[model samples]
Target: MNNLEKWFHSNLGVLRRISQIGALVLVVLIPILNKNEIYILLGNFYSLSIGNLEIADPAIVAQTILLTKKVFLPLLLAGLIPIVITLFLGKVFCSWACPYFLISEMGAKLRSIFKTPQPSLKNPKPQYYWFIFAGVMLFAIISGVPIITYFSFPGLISSNIANLVLCGIVGVELFFIFVILLSEMVFDSRFWCKYFCPVGAVLSLFLSKNTLKIKLNSVACGNCEKLSESPCINACVLNLNPKKENLYPYCNHCFACVDSCQNYGNALTITFQNKEK
Candidate 1:
């Protein structure tokens, strides 16, 4: 009933993207602005601190834990922070903070413009790839490599950005991201994120059946009979049926479904602590 773009523009999901883009910007600025270690609050991808608060990627912790079998309180807390947040907020970090998401979203958009053909998954269970990632990390940890740092997409992008600016050292990790970009452009666009991030998989282990989630009002959803298809499912990057309760760990909490709903039935809403919107 209104300009489609305007309708899309009116949702709260834009705030999510803004925060993600903002974090990406800060990664760039941190290395550029802080030449002297005067600021202790700033940090890179695997770990970050704001004043006394430290947040670390739990996958890094897992790698270290597997290697050392001992938990250092400070680093343990650093890693647990993100995991704990995931437990309460769903995988908000993937949708709202990862730098790789912006690039992948652009690639996905471009692929859509070209009508890029993607093969349907034989096993639609998205977390299968996450397990593959976890297995690799586990093997690497056992092999004494702690290789998640060397191979993680976000870790690489965050590491390289910090290295290139801070130490003037460029590594091969950028090439890895380029290859992933090409993959998204030519094939399954949301493949890596939808199915495979080890760090995301690690964080997902903390998600519970009822932890902050999307709720569907079946009556309102069913009454919207004029639609060509289910917008909630179509809007999902991870190919999830947002109207269902069985959302897997792959959900990034991107809220694209909410944005796509606009003035429609509005049956799908994110619920915090079992409270209805």
Candidate 2:
């Protein structure tokens, strides 16, 4: 195996957790450093400035453009980076760096330990996510308010982190997040990301036939159906079936399934290939 393959084989899960933790740390650290008068990294998830470069959430950028009816070139450019990245890599940000997703995963672990009567892990129709995204955008346009930003859990969490760091008080958004977390812990897992996250919904639109996605080798996946539960499926916090062809829309490219597949015929792989081919 190549060095890259070997590295991933041994470290995919570790690497993903590191990225998730780093994202959380960066969210808090950016505001703290800025409060110390360091201007190197600025802004929250809605809009982030690293040195002279700006990176922003495309969904929010689109909302701003739609609401204000002006291009605002800098904001457009900031949003473009994420769109292009999403086209290439899929909605990896959700799995690798979204603070809310990290928090939800942690909550899921706690739920597992407490052992509540788990609802069926099957996600509702993926169409509901896009419906929420479109509905929020339409509401923002009609109300002349950026209500879409308020609905973005990642942006809200990051912005609230900054608010607490800089202003010494938490925004009400934190309570919104807590309520959702509590609902998921008690009733379902990944309820928001699977059915309601507008940010993820918007990003998923950028995925194309050639975007990176999970591919399953049916031949290599020997007799996993005979097992009570496949290791790869169990490894996925989203409880996704990595072997399924229709996995892209819901799959976050976390590679947890790929890591788990190593001991079980190495059936799952991440690749950039046209789905039609």
Per-residue CA lDDT of model 2 for 182-260, tens digit only, reads: 9999877878887678788778888998888777777788847644377776777776666554565777778888898
**Residue pairs with clashing backbones, model 1:** none
What ranges in model 1 sit over 4 Å off?
1-10, 116-123, 126-130, 223-228, 244-246, 273-277
Each model's lDDT comes to 0.74, 0.83
The true-versus-predicted C-alpha distance at residue 8 of model 2, in Å, is 1.2
Q: What's the residue-level lDDT of 65 in candidate 2?
A: 93
lDDT of 1 by residue, 1-277 (tens): 3565455445557777789889888888877767766575578787887778888889888888788888888998898788878888888888888988878887887888889443232225644756687678768866888777676677678878988889899887788778978987776777788776777778778887667777776666763553326665667766566765446666787878777765677666666657554
Structure candidate 2, residue pairs in collision: none
